[model samples]
Target: MMISNTPPPPYYAVIFTSVRTNDNEGYAETDALMSELALQQDGFLGMEHASSEIGITISYWRDVESIKHWKDNLDHQKAQIKGQKTWYSQYKVRIAKVERDYDFLKK
Candidate 1:
């Protein structure tokens, strides 16, 4: 996935790290659906994701309210339950405020 184009260094980021249980049932579809659904939310800024031995998905938000709104989404909540019960062997969620960021690209 490409890096997310965020406006500045004032947004919030929900960092999700996970290790899977090798149970792929319903995971890919639900993950894609959740990403699409997040884009439809009020203050979703952008997202970046990657997976390997350890997986990391960072979703950017406009503010704490936006993050909370996502946390309350019923579909996402259901996914969370399913993940706990079946998908992940272990996982962690971290929310942090962005204070500074920098990047560059070759022209």
Candidate 2:
């Protein structure tokens, strides 16, 4: 995926870092579904992710209330449960406010 074209400073980011378990059981489908569901949320701005032995996904949001709403979503909660019981060997979530951001592109 390309970089998310987020707005200027003052957005929230939910940073999800994860190491996977060996089980391939439906993980990819679940992941894709979550992405689709997140995009439909009220304040979802964008998302970016990469993975090797570990994975990191940062989902941008309009505000903390939006983040909370997403977290409380029933489907998302089910996915979280499944991740803990199946897909992820370990993971961490960090929420932060983006007060500043910059990027450079090559021509």
Candidate 3:
């Protein structure tokens, strides 16, 4: 799902970029679960994701603390382990503060 209702600027964005391995055994299920769990997190703003040769999932949070909490979440940790072992070939995570943002929507 596309996350449209993002909060106003000055939030945090965790940009997860990954290259997948051929073995995708349980990737989809785990990914869906992670997204579901993130929504339940305290400072979650929203998320936008896309996948192809390289996959990118950008999750927005209220602050760095919230992002840290999500990173250390037990279930998420497990998913990380699984991704390291099976799903992803390589990945990079970058967190940045959204200083300003503007968008135009076509009706």
Candidate 4:
């Protein structure tokens, strides 16, 4: 499948999808924190997103180890726990490695 501004070859993409709970407290704060930390991580590259209720954020990373580190990061882990308990009604994370990619932009 063709995606806009396809990620460069040989990168890891962490696809995050979430259904937010309307009454959850600290949702925006935690979400923002996660984004900030992700950008600062060792293997961080870049990200793109299309979000609403069921949102998707694909973050590019250097390798599996970096991705795994993010997965187990203390702050992010706390946020994940909070999300499961109070923020997200449901969520799923999928990681994929891109060996090749292509895109077409309007001229």
Report the number of the highest-lDDT candidate: 2
**Against the hidden true structure, what lDDT does model 1 obtain?**
0.95
In TM-score terms, candidate 4 sits at: 0.85
Q: Per-residue lDDT for 36-78 in model 4, tens only?
A: 9997899888777787768788888989999999989999999
Q: Flag the better candidate by TM-score, 3 or 4.
A: 3
In model 1, the runs with Cα more than 4 Å from the true position are none
Error of 3 at 38 (Å): 0.2
Quote the RMSD, in angstroms, for model 2.
0.6
**Candidate 2 lDDT by residue in tens digits, 13-90:** 999999999998999999999999999999999999999989999999999999999999999999999999999989
- Which candidate, 1 or 4, has the higher lDDT? 1
The Cα local distance difference test for each model comes to 0.95, 0.97, 0.92, 0.83
Cα lDDT tens digits, model 1, 18-106, are 99998999999999999999999999999999888999999999999989999999999999999999999999999999989999999
Tens digit of per-residue lDDT, candidate 3, span 1-107: 75557788999999999999999788889989998999999999999999888999999999999999999999999999999999888999999999999888789
What is the C-alpha RMSD, rounded to one decimal, of candidate 3? 0.8
State in Å the error of residue 78, model 4. 0.6
**Candidate 2 positional error at 22, Å:** 0.4
Candidate 3: Cα lDDT at 78: 100
Q: What's the residue-level lDDT of 8 in candidate 3?
A: 87
Candidates' RMSD to native: 0.6, 0.6, 0.8, 3.3
What count of clashes does model 2 give?
A: 0
lDDT computed for candidate 2: 0.97
Per candidate, the number of residue pairs that clash is 0, 0, 0, 0
